[model samples]
Target: MYINLHNMQAIIALACGVLILIMPKLLNYIVALYLIILGVMGIVRF
Candidate 1:
Protein backbone atom coordinates (compact mmCIF):
# COMPACT_ATOMS: atom_id res chain seq x y z
CA MET A 1 0.00 0.00 0.00
CA TYR A 2 2.70 2.46 -0.95
CA ILE A 3 0.89 5.22 -2.78
CA ASN A 4 2.97 8.07 -4.18
CA LEU A 5 2.07 11.66 -3.63
CA HIS A 6 2.07 12.51 -7.33
CA ASN A 7 -0.41 9.75 -8.06
CA MET A 8 -2.51 10.88 -5.14
CA GLN A 9 -2.42 14.45 -6.37
CA ALA A 10 -3.55 13.40 -9.83
CA ILE A 11 -6.42 11.43 -8.38
CA ILE A 12 -7.41 14.36 -6.22
CA ALA A 13 -7.20 16.74 -9.16
CA LEU A 14 -9.45 14.51 -11.23
CA ALA A 15 -11.91 14.27 -8.40
CA CYS A 16 -11.79 18.02 -7.97
CA GLY A 17 -12.62 18.49 -11.63
CA VAL A 18 -15.72 16.38 -11.19
CA LEU A 19 -16.62 18.23 -8.03
CA ILE A 20 -16.10 21.55 -9.76
CA LEU A 21 -18.67 20.58 -12.37
CA ILE A 22 -21.12 20.13 -9.52
CA MET A 23 -20.09 22.94 -7.14
CA PRO A 24 -17.86 25.21 -9.26
CA LYS A 25 -16.44 26.93 -6.20
CA LEU A 26 -13.56 24.47 -5.91
CA LEU A 27 -12.16 25.33 -9.33
CA ASN A 28 -9.74 27.99 -8.19
CA TYR A 29 -8.19 26.30 -5.18
CA ILE A 30 -8.18 22.81 -6.59
CA VAL A 31 -6.68 23.74 -9.96
CA ALA A 32 -4.25 26.15 -8.39
CA LEU A 33 -3.03 23.66 -5.89
CA TYR A 34 -2.77 20.95 -8.51
CA LEU A 35 -0.76 23.15 -10.86
CA ILE A 36 1.49 24.40 -8.10
CA ILE A 37 2.18 20.91 -6.91
CA LEU A 38 2.74 19.60 -10.43
CA GLY A 39 5.00 22.52 -11.25
CA VAL A 40 7.04 22.00 -8.16
CA MET A 41 7.26 18.33 -8.84
CA GLY A 42 8.42 18.97 -12.38
CA ILE A 43 11.02 21.47 -11.27
CA VAL A 44 12.28 19.26 -8.52
CA ARG A 45 12.30 16.23 -10.84
CA PHE A 46 10.21 14.13 -8.52
Candidate 2:
Protein backbone atom coordinates (compact mmCIF):
# COMPACT_ATOMS: atom_id res chain seq x y z
CA MET A 1 0.00 0.00 0.00
CA TYR A 2 2.06 2.85 -1.30
CA ILE A 3 0.24 6.10 -0.81
CA ASN A 4 1.65 9.14 -2.53
CA LEU A 5 2.04 12.54 -0.86
CA HIS A 6 -1.10 13.90 -2.49
CA ASN A 7 -3.19 10.94 -1.36
CA MET A 8 -1.89 11.23 2.16
CA GLN A 9 -2.79 14.90 2.26
CA ALA A 10 -6.21 14.13 0.90
CA ILE A 11 -6.79 11.51 3.56
CA ILE A 12 -5.66 13.90 6.25
CA ALA A 13 -7.99 16.56 4.96
CA LEU A 14 -10.91 14.14 4.84
CA ALA A 15 -10.29 12.94 8.36
CA CYS A 16 -9.97 16.49 9.61
CA GLY A 17 -13.19 17.46 7.87
CA VAL A 18 -15.06 14.60 9.52
CA LEU A 19 -13.56 15.42 12.88
CA ILE A 20 -14.53 19.06 12.54
CA LEU A 21 -18.06 18.00 11.73
CA ILE A 22 -18.20 15.86 14.83
CA MET A 23 -16.51 18.41 17.09
CA PRO A 24 -16.57 21.93 15.81
CA LYS A 25 -14.17 23.09 18.48
CA LEU A 26 -11.45 20.98 16.85
CA LEU A 27 -11.57 23.30 13.86
CA ASN A 28 -9.18 25.77 15.45
CA TYR A 29 -6.57 23.16 16.30
CA ILE A 30 -6.99 21.37 13.01
CA VAL A 31 -6.63 24.54 11.00
CA ALA A 32 -3.63 25.63 13.00
CA LEU A 33 -1.91 22.30 12.56
CA TYR A 34 -2.81 22.19 8.90
CA LEU A 35 -1.26 25.58 8.32
CA ILE A 36 1.85 24.61 10.26
CA ILE A 37 2.19 21.40 8.27
CA LEU A 38 1.70 23.27 5.03
CA GLY A 39 4.37 25.77 5.97
CA VAL A 40 6.80 23.03 6.88
CA MET A 41 6.09 21.13 3.70
CA GLY A 42 6.54 24.30 1.69
CA ILE A 43 9.85 25.06 3.34
CA VAL A 44 11.04 21.50 2.95
CA ARG A 45 9.65 21.26 -0.59
CA PHE A 46 8.26 17.81 0.02
Candidate 3:
Protein backbone atom coordinates (compact mmCIF):
# COMPACT_ATOMS: atom_id res chain seq x y z
CA MET A 1 0.00 0.00 0.00
CA TYR A 2 2.97 2.28 -0.33
CA ILE A 3 3.31 3.95 -3.74
CA ASN A 4 6.04 6.39 -4.71
CA LEU A 5 5.54 9.38 -6.97
CA HIS A 6 7.07 7.78 -10.05
CA ASN A 7 4.93 4.68 -9.64
CA MET A 8 1.83 6.78 -9.07
CA GLN A 9 2.57 8.81 -12.17
CA ALA A 10 3.02 5.69 -14.23
CA ILE A 11 -0.28 4.28 -12.99
CA ILE A 12 -2.12 7.50 -13.72
CA ALA A 13 -0.56 7.80 -17.13
CA LEU A 14 -1.50 4.23 -17.96
CA ALA A 15 -5.08 4.81 -16.89
CA CYS A 16 -5.24 8.01 -18.89
CA GLY A 17 -3.86 6.25 -21.93
CA VAL A 18 -6.57 3.63 -21.71
CA LEU A 19 -9.21 6.30 -21.28
CA ILE A 20 -7.89 8.24 -24.28
CA LEU A 21 -7.94 5.10 -26.38
CA ILE A 22 -11.56 4.54 -25.46
CA MET A 23 -12.80 8.14 -25.71
CA PRO A 24 -10.23 9.89 -27.91
CA LYS A 25 -11.79 13.31 -27.19
CA LEU A 26 -10.30 13.72 -23.72
CA LEU A 27 -6.70 13.67 -24.88
CA ASN A 28 -6.11 17.39 -24.37
CA TYR A 29 -7.67 17.61 -20.94
CA ILE A 30 -6.07 14.42 -19.71
CA VAL A 31 -2.59 15.48 -20.75
CA ALA A 32 -3.00 18.95 -19.33
CA LEU A 33 -4.33 17.66 -16.03
CA TYR A 34 -1.62 15.07 -15.86
CA LEU A 35 1.08 17.67 -16.37
CA ILE A 36 -0.43 19.98 -13.80
CA ILE A 37 -0.73 17.22 -11.23
CA LEU A 38 2.80 15.95 -11.91
CA GLY A 39 4.18 19.44 -11.59
CA VAL A 40 2.39 20.07 -8.34
CA MET A 41 3.45 16.73 -6.94
CA GLY A 42 7.04 17.36 -7.96
CA ILE A 43 7.10 20.74 -6.32
CA VAL A 44 5.29 19.75 -3.14
CA ARG A 45 7.11 16.46 -2.78
CA PHE A 46 4.26 14.84 -0.97
Candidate 4:
Protein backbone atom coordinates (compact mmCIF):
# COMPACT_ATOMS: atom_id res chain seq x y z
CA MET A 1 0.00 0.00 0.00
CA TYR A 2 1.10 3.54 -0.69
CA ILE A 3 1.65 4.82 2.83
CA ASN A 4 1.42 8.57 3.18
CA LEU A 5 1.49 11.18 5.90
CA HIS A 6 -2.10 10.74 6.99
CA ASN A 7 -1.79 6.98 7.09
CA MET A 8 1.40 7.14 9.11
CA GLN A 9 -0.16 9.66 11.44
CA ALA A 10 -3.25 7.49 11.89
CA ILE A 11 -1.07 4.51 12.70
CA ILE A 12 0.92 6.50 15.22
CA ALA A 13 -2.27 7.81 16.79
CA LEU A 14 -3.74 4.35 16.98
CA ALA A 15 -0.61 2.94 18.58
CA CYS A 16 -0.51 5.78 21.09
CA GLY A 17 -4.18 5.29 21.88
CA VAL A 18 -3.62 1.63 22.57
CA LEU A 19 -0.60 2.38 24.75
CA ILE A 20 -2.53 4.97 26.72
CA LEU A 21 -5.34 2.51 27.23
CA ILE A 22 -2.94 -0.14 28.42
CA MET A 23 -0.86 1.97 30.80
CA PRO A 24 -3.09 4.92 31.68
CA LYS A 25 -0.06 6.47 33.35
CA LEU A 26 2.50 6.77 30.58
CA LEU A 27 -0.02 8.86 28.70
CA ASN A 28 1.99 12.01 29.26
CA TYR A 29 5.24 10.48 28.07
CA ILE A 30 3.60 8.79 25.11
CA VAL A 31 1.95 12.00 23.97
CA ALA A 32 5.06 14.06 24.52
CA LEU A 33 7.18 11.64 22.53
CA TYR A 34 4.58 11.44 19.81
CA LEU A 35 4.48 15.22 19.47
CA ILE A 36 8.23 15.46 19.50
CA ILE A 37 8.59 12.84 16.81
CA LEU A 38 5.87 14.45 14.78
CA GLY A 39 7.50 17.83 15.14
CA VAL A 40 10.83 16.43 14.01
CA MET A 41 9.20 14.67 11.09
CA GLY A 42 7.46 17.88 10.09
CA ILE A 43 10.70 19.83 10.28
CA VAL A 44 12.47 17.19 8.19
CA ARG A 45 9.49 16.97 5.79
CA PHE A 46 9.40 13.23 6.14
| lDDT minimum window of 10 residues, candidate 4 | 37-46
Per-residue C-alpha lDDT of model 1 across residues 5-30, encoded as one tens digit per residue: 86787678689979999989978887
Instruction: Report, for every candidate in turn, its global Cα lDDT versus the true structure.
Output: 0.84, 0.96, 0.89, 0.91
Candidates 1 and 2: which is better by lDDT? 2
TM-score of 2: 0.85
Q: Give the candidate order by descending lDDT.
A: 2, 4, 3, 1
What TM-score against the true fold does each predicted structure earn? 0.58, 0.85, 0.79, 0.83
Show where candidate 3 strays beyond 4 Å.
Answer: none
- How does model 1 score by TM-score? 0.58
**Which pairs of residues clash in candidate 2, taking residues 3 or more apart in a chain or in different chains?**
none
lDDT of candidate 2 vs native?
Answer: 0.96
TM-score quality measure for candidate 4:
0.83
The lDDT, on a scale of 0 to 1, for candidate 4 is 0.91
lDDT of 4 by residue, 1-46 (tens): 9998899989989998998899999899998898899899889985
lDDT of 2 by residue, 9-28 (tens): 99999999999999999999
